[model samples]
Target: MRKTIALFVLTLVICSCVSATPIAVAEGEADRFESWNETDFLKDFVSNNLDRTVATAGEEKAGDYVLSVLEKMGYTTRKDNGLTSAKQRFDYVDSINGDANVGYNIVARKDVSGATEFVIIGCHYDNLTSYELNGEKVGGEGAGEATGVAVMLKLAYDLRYETLPFNVVFVAFGGNQLGLYGAEKFIGANQSIVDNTLLMLNLDSVGVGDYLYMYADEVSTKHEDFVYDLSEKLNLDVRKPPKDKKIVAAKIRDDSKLPYHHKGLLSENSLFLDYGVNTLNLFGYNWTGEGYGGESENHPDIVGTKRDTLSNYLAYYSESGQKKMETATALVKAAVTAEDFSAVMKESKKEKFDYSWLVSDKVRIGVSLGILAVLAAAAALVYVKLDKIQKNSKKAEDKSDDFQKQSEKVFEDF
Candidate 1:
C-alpha cells in the first residue's frame, strides 16, 4: 500500500509538471508559400487589380477571384452578402452613396468529421478610394490588404486536404476600408458560429511593413504568446506593440472602452474582439514610427496611398515582405494545427466581462450624486425628528416645572 501510494503521488507530480506540447512545424513548412506558387498568386492578384474599393467593379472582380480560387481548391465556397437566411440585413451605409450597401464577404470552409469548433482566418480585400498624404492625393492600391488575402489563400490551399481537428473558415471581407462592414455582417449573420468559434486569426497589412507585429484581444494573451513563441522558434522577428507614449496615446484616443479599442491597431478584428472572441491579428507595421510606417530604413508609409502598389513593394522590400508573409503563414498554421490546440484554446478562452458601465465617469458621477442625495435626505430627516423630540422633551419639562410652581403657590395661599 505504501509503495502504491508513493507511485500515485509520483504520477500526479509528473502529470502536474508536464505541459501540453504545441504543434511542431518543419523548417521547410515556412517555404511552402513559395513552393506552392502562392507568391506568384499574390503578385498576380495584386497586379491584376487597380483598387478593390467597396461597391465597385474592382471589388466584385476581387471577390470573384477569391471564390474561383477557393472553388478550385475543392473547398465549399459561398458569398455572404451581409444578409441572414432569415432575411435580416447586415448591410452598411456606403460613404459615397449614403445608401445601404451589401459588402460581399467571401467565405470558404473546410470541415472535419466530428469537429464542433471553428478556426476562422480573415482578411479584408477592400482598399480606400484615395488618401491625401503630405498634401498629395494618391490612389489606394492596398498592397497590404492584398498581401493578407494572398496569405489567407495560401493557408486555405495548403490546409485543403488535411483533416484538421476543427473546421477552418477563410473569409475575405469587403468594405473594410469604409468600415468593418464585412466582418460585422459575418458576425451578425452567424450568431451560432460566434459561439462555436475557437479562434479568429486576422491578417492585415502583413507584408511591406518594417516589422511583423502580433496583436491579440485583451481577454487573453495565450494565443499571442503561442504565436510569438512560434516566431522565435522559426527565427522570425515578430514584435508586440511597444509601451511608448505615442502608442499609448493612440490607444487612449481610440478608446471606446471596448476590448479591441485597447489595442493599437483597429481592423476587422475589432468586431470579433467586441464579440468576446479570442482573436489574433497579424499586422506588418512599425509601432515605433509615425503614421503606420515601419521603423526600418526606407520603409515607406504607403498603405493607404497610391504608392502601395505591388511594384513598389517588390522593388523596395520584397525580401522582407515575403519573409513576413512566410512567418505569418507558418506561425498561424502551427497554431491552428497544434496537437494541443484545444487545450491552448481552453486556456485562452476567458470571459471578458465589460465593466465599462461601472467604470464610466458619467455613471460613477451619477451614482455618487444619487448616493449623496439619499444620504443628505436621510440626514435631514433624522435631524428634523431629533429636533422635534428635543423640543417636545423641553416642553414637557417646562410644563412639569409650571405645575409644581402652581401647586406651591396654592399651598401658600391656603
Candidate 2:
C-alpha cells in the first residue's frame, strides 16, 4: 500500500509539470496567412446587392446579409441605432426622407480571455442609389464598397477562432453615403469601447483603384509603421499617399487649420480621431493621377458612378482588385494577432510630430520667395561695396602719381 501511494504521487507530479509548461506564443506571422480566395464571394455580393443606398430596402437587405454572415460564423450579433435623437441635424436625412431609425450599425464582438483592450474592424456598406452623371442616370455599382466589406468579413471569418491578445469588434456601418451618420452615431454610443480601443481599422474602397494605400491619424503612426513593415515582410505592395500630392490636396481643401488632417483621410476614420483613438484606414485610391484628388479625371472612374459595377471592375482591374483585398486581409490579420500587440498599442498612443507643412506648396512657395529676396538683396549690397572699393583705389593711384611728379620737379630744381 505504501509503494502504490508513492507511485500515484509521482504520477501526479509529472502531470502537473507537463500541464504547467507554457505554450508557444501566438505570433501572427506572414507565413501563417495564405492567399485568400474571395473572388466568388466578392462577385456574388456586388451582383446581388447593387444599390445599397441609405434608408432603402436595398440597404436593409445588405445589412441583413452582413448580420446573417456574422451569425452563421457563430458570432453574437447586435445593432446600434446610431444617433436616433439627432436625425434632424443631417440635411441628407431630410432630403432622403430618412428618419432617426434609418441607419443601424451592425456589430459583432469576439472576446478573448483576460484581454483588456479591443480592436475594431469597420466598413460602410451603403452606396449611392442612383445619381445623374454626364446626363445619364446611373445605378450605384459599388464595387469598391463591396470590396471593403468583403475584406472585413473575410477577416472576421479567418480570425474567428484565433487566440488574440485583445478582443475584436466588427462593425458594418450604415448611412455612410449619407454623410458618415452611422459612424458618428456609433462613436457617440460606444464611448467606453472607443476609450479602451487599441486600434480602429477602417477599410474603404479597397477595390477598383490604382494603388493599395494605408493612412493613419497622427497618434497611430506606430501602428501604421508596423503594418507597413509587415506588408513588406509578406511581399505585399502597400503604399502611403505621396508626400507632395497629399500636401497639395490638403492645401486645396484648406485643411491646414485641422491638427490631425495630415495623418488621416476624409472618411469614417476621421470620426475615431475625434475621440483620441488610434485609427488606420486601408484604402485603395489612385495617387498616380496628375489631378489633385483621388477621384480626379486621371484616377479610376468608379465609386458612385455607373462604371462601379463588378462586371466593369472585373473586366478592367480584376487582378489588381484581388491583390488589394488579399494584401489588406493579410496585413490586418497579422496586425490584430501580433504577439507584440501590447507594445504596439503602447507605442501607438504617442503622437508624432506633423511634418506635412514641410511639403506644402504654400509653405514651399513662401520660403522660396523669401530665399530669393534675401539672395537678391545680398548680391546688390556686394556689388555696391565692390564699386566703392574700386573708386577709392583709383583715387589713391592718382594721388601717388601726383606725388611722384612733385618729387621729380623738386629734384630737377635742386
Estimate every model's Cα lDDT from 0 to 1.
0.66, 0.65
lDDT tens per residue, model 2, 211-295: 7888875433787788788889888889876664443223212223233243235567766765567888887776666544453
What TM-score goes with each of the models? 0.71, 0.67
Runs of candidate 1 exceeding 4 Å displacement: 1-34, 77-90, 95-97, 129-138, 245-256, 259-263, 290-296, 351-414
Q: Whose lDDT is greatest here?
A: 1
Question: How many steric clashes between backbone atoms does each model show?
Answer: 0, 0
- Weakest 10 consecutive residues of candidate 2 by summed lDDT: 1-10
| TM-score, predicted candidate 1 vs. hidden true structure | 0.71
Worst 10 residues of 1 by lDDT: 1-10
